[model samples]
Target: MHRMKEFYLVSDRHIRYAMMKAFFDARMIEGSSVREHGVMMLSLVEKLKDLQADFNKEETYVDVILQSLPPSFDQCIMNYNMNWLEKNLHELINMLV
Candidate 1:
């Protein structure tokens, strides 16, 4: 039983790590709209949540989404940083769209 528990824990950790990597490495394709990209990121976040990953929804998740944006959005990213804007996932998506 103890070994079984250990195996499950390890499995969960691996799964969590893969999910986190996917979230961080996600990028907006050239043809994709901001809304589509944002939704994909949000879906990854939800999967991480289901795995009980320890992350701040408002900070880590939002930052990952922003950073995953393409170079075309550099100006938007700059504006958000320069103004110190605090936006949630949905709000950020709407703004980008």
Candidate 2:
């Protein structure tokens, strides 16, 4: 039973690592709408939550989405930072779209 528990913990850790990697590596492809990208990112967040991963939804996820945007969004990103804007994922997606 102890070995089984250890194996499960290790498996869970591996799954969490893979999910975190995917979340960080996510990038908005050209021609994709901001809404689609945001939704996909949000989905990954939800999955991570289910796995009990520790993450700051307000900042980390938002930053990840912003960083994932292509160069075409540089102006928008600058404006957001310049204005000290605080927007949730859904709100940011709406603004970008």
Candidate 3:
């Protein structure tokens, strides 16, 4: 019998590129699309996985996304701490919707 381990290759450049792209795309979210946008952004941020040292990056990303929303979202933003570490992205997405 033989045992084998599998490994996958990932490029730093690709990861960085993806992160930036997702960040920019999330920033572009607005109005009625906030739900779908939040979902996508959440997925993108989660994809960072081991590439990110801590949740700070995700926190900043969510903060920017919230700031980019229209005035209607002001109350939610004000009521919540916007601390990604304290809140789950799925909950944020639900609130946005």
lDDT of each: 0.83, 0.83, 0.62
Q: Clashing pairs in model 3?
A: none
Candidate 2 off by > 4 Å: 1-10
* Candidate 1 local lDDT, 1-97, one digit each (tens): 2364487765777787888999989989876788888888888888888888958556788788989998899999999989999988788888989
TM-score of each: 0.82, 0.82, 0.58
- Model 2 clash pairs are none
Whose TM-score is higher: candidate 1's or candidate 3's? 1
Better of 2 and 3 by lDDT: 2
What are the per-residue Cα lDDT tens digits for candidate 3 across 33-94?
77777776776666555455235555676676676677777777877764433556677678
Candidate 1 worst ten-residue window by lDDT: 1-10
- What global local distance difference test value does model 3 have? 0.62
Q: Where in model 1 is the C-alpha error above 4 Å? A: 1-10
